[model samples]
Target: MNSNFSLPNQKSKAILERYASSMSTSNAVSFPMVISHGEGCWLTDVDGNKYLDMMAGIAVNTTGYAHPAVVKAVQEQAAKVQHLCFAVFASEPQVALAERLKKHVGQDYRVFFGNSGTEGIEAAMKLARYHTKRPYFIAFTGSFHGRSMGALSLTASVSKYRKGFGNLVPGVFHAPYPQPYKYPRTAEMVLEHLEFLFKHTTPPEEVAGIFVEPIQGEGGYIVPPAGFMQDLRSICDKHGILLVADEVQTGVGRTGQFLASEFDNVQPDIVVLAKGLASGYPISAVMFKEHISTWGAGAHGTTFGGNPVSSAAALATLDILENGAMENARVQGEYLLGRMRALQARVPQLGDVRGRGLMIGLEFVKDPVSKLEHPELRDRVQQLGLEHGLILLGAGSHAIRLAPPLVLTTEDAKYAADTLEKIILEAASH
Candidate 1:
């Protein structure tokens, strides 16, 4: 073998061995190739292999990598003032970003800035507890809130995530959510379970908030049936419990809309956003209705939550998402989902294809009759994409998630569909 051809791949392996953690992390179905650079919807590996990125850093990049407007805004903001520590000195960028986010939330809403989705969830939890003077919360099973203790307490997606983390935050109760593909339960049944929970388990009077994902992200990207959120909202209102939407993955135009909750006409009492808010910058927003403003000063504070540079990037990201990226999502998502539906009819392993906008999920099963989840096949299909210079991620038990950048074009959609078809067909044969 020629040494030149092997050099690039070997260098990546070497760097990973030397600097990266040894613990095996198999979340992304990550390929061995080291990324050299990224543009709109593509990433080039160190070995010069170009991959169409369908994961979009797990629905974080709203405007794509190194977007000109976002980059320029970040550069200019950094030159002016990178760190004003919003707690100490009021930052113009922070205030401007808050003003922009305000319109998206609603007229009578308040914004709390943080650095990640989990932090936002934490804030929402605190605010709910403080405002309601309640000690309990209701979180849906098969949901991924975050990894921190407080948020993790609300997360019930995978048992492995909470296996050994004993002494997990208490005061959190889990209720089943509707999953058509995996479970036989319907929205009505889930609502009944909530009713049972309120009666038998934790009393609604003691519950502060009910946390939910507008479109469940890690739990197979499952989107509950119509009227689910509406029913849940009514229940929350009836009990004086806050309805909290964990929009960390579905917010910021990932679902072809500003918020996935918007589609159901269900207004959440609190909205937690992060992933696409600043493209790739670390920023999370916890927006709540104005009525929950019982929080006083010194209750919560972060030193670097509202960094000026990140705020500028967020402002730029919103500009792009509103101007063009959102419409692209609205159009291209339909095209991609249509192709996937056609493919689903032809492929036996493809058990289900469902999602809204760009946040699609392609679920795999062992066979049509059994309908048993084929997680192995799902992993193989993901690996096949990586081997063929395509980037994608797996979610839940046996589903591949497609959450490409909002800027994905029709051409990109065609390429993704074609590539997925090729990959799935080849895997099926094996």
Candidate 2:
């Protein structure tokens, strides 16, 4: 903890206490540090403790916190105007951001704005169903789309998010995700299973679409096997079903590309983006191929979807990410992974290290003799990282997620990896 910072003020403490008692307890919190400000790849708490932010607000902040370019863009746009709904009159910032994203993705693309990732997911789902004229969707097990009803119905990660929320939007089916390390099923086997289900169970003609993360974010940052995405694309194409790539956490240079699908060079029919889109401002979007943007004018809309301020922030953030921040992610991400593997050699509990660019996962497993999950040891290691100066987040049932800002430097990555190794060693010894 830095010595220069003061603790949280009485006003802040009171507000937090009130929020805890009055607000819904459904909001699960992991870290306890009261974040006050963020810069680059680091965050400072009210008590003035500076921590290396490896989670990057759950893979947002691609341009890092309070970047000068984004700040200037927001300031300039705010001075002109802040709230101008796109429904009435399309603003320049929103239009520019769309064009920018379109250029990055492809020429024949259109964009729809929303306030969060779930909103974007909802829009994509609606468009898929409307365009295909089908009632069923094919999703993967251990996938996380979002938390809204439509998105929640599509999400198949955990039961807690869906518990008591039934009967959810029906016709959603979960198949095996292409996790080469964990699942014994190969891409062909999984696709064959999917084909079997579509033919025998749901009927391919009745299927609306298939949704996937280019890399599974919440489900341990699972990278699909080679040619897996291509096979899925082919499957969707053959069935005339839409392919929706949920790049919510993997987009914006988190995986060394504007969209993780770019790495495989397979274009999806629709891409859902959020988290890093507007830096810290709340904005998300569903980008669709020109042919699929068939919704009528009154079909769907949101009040704050593309507000000028958020658009400006998004535009500036995009500028920074496109320029050099993303490339940095690739270089530093490899360095971080290398260091982590070295740590793994020393700490046997750190079983697997996976993910691309800055979106990384370190899975903790019990001793090989037992081969079970070591949640107790994982908790201690995570707490030790917090006790030091790093804020590491957990993923899936037994893995730690490291999604630092793309702007993170190699030095910062080294420090975080080294600090994490020391903590894990101490915990393992205990």
Which prediction has the highest TM-score against the true structure? 1
Q: Write the per-residue lDDT of candidate 1 for residues 86-119, one digit (tens) a residue.
A: 6788888888988898887787888889999999
The C-alpha lDDT values of all candidates are: 0.88, 0.85
Model 2 lDDT tens row, 1-430? 2112223346435555666787677766576557789888888877677889888888887777888898998899889999988888889889888998988888898999999999999999999988888999989988999998999998988898899999888999988897666555688998988988987888887888899998998888888887888998998889888889999999877888888998778899999999998888999988999998788997889888988899999888888877888898898889888988888889878877887899988888787445578877777877788778888888888888999888898789889978987898998887
Off by over 4 Å in 2: 1-16, 368-370
**Structural similarity to truth (TM-score) of each candidate:** 0.96, 0.95
The runs of at least 3 residues in candidate 1 whose Cα sits more than 4 Å from the true structure, single-residue gaps closed, are 1-8, 20-29
Query: Highest lDDT, which number?
Result: 1
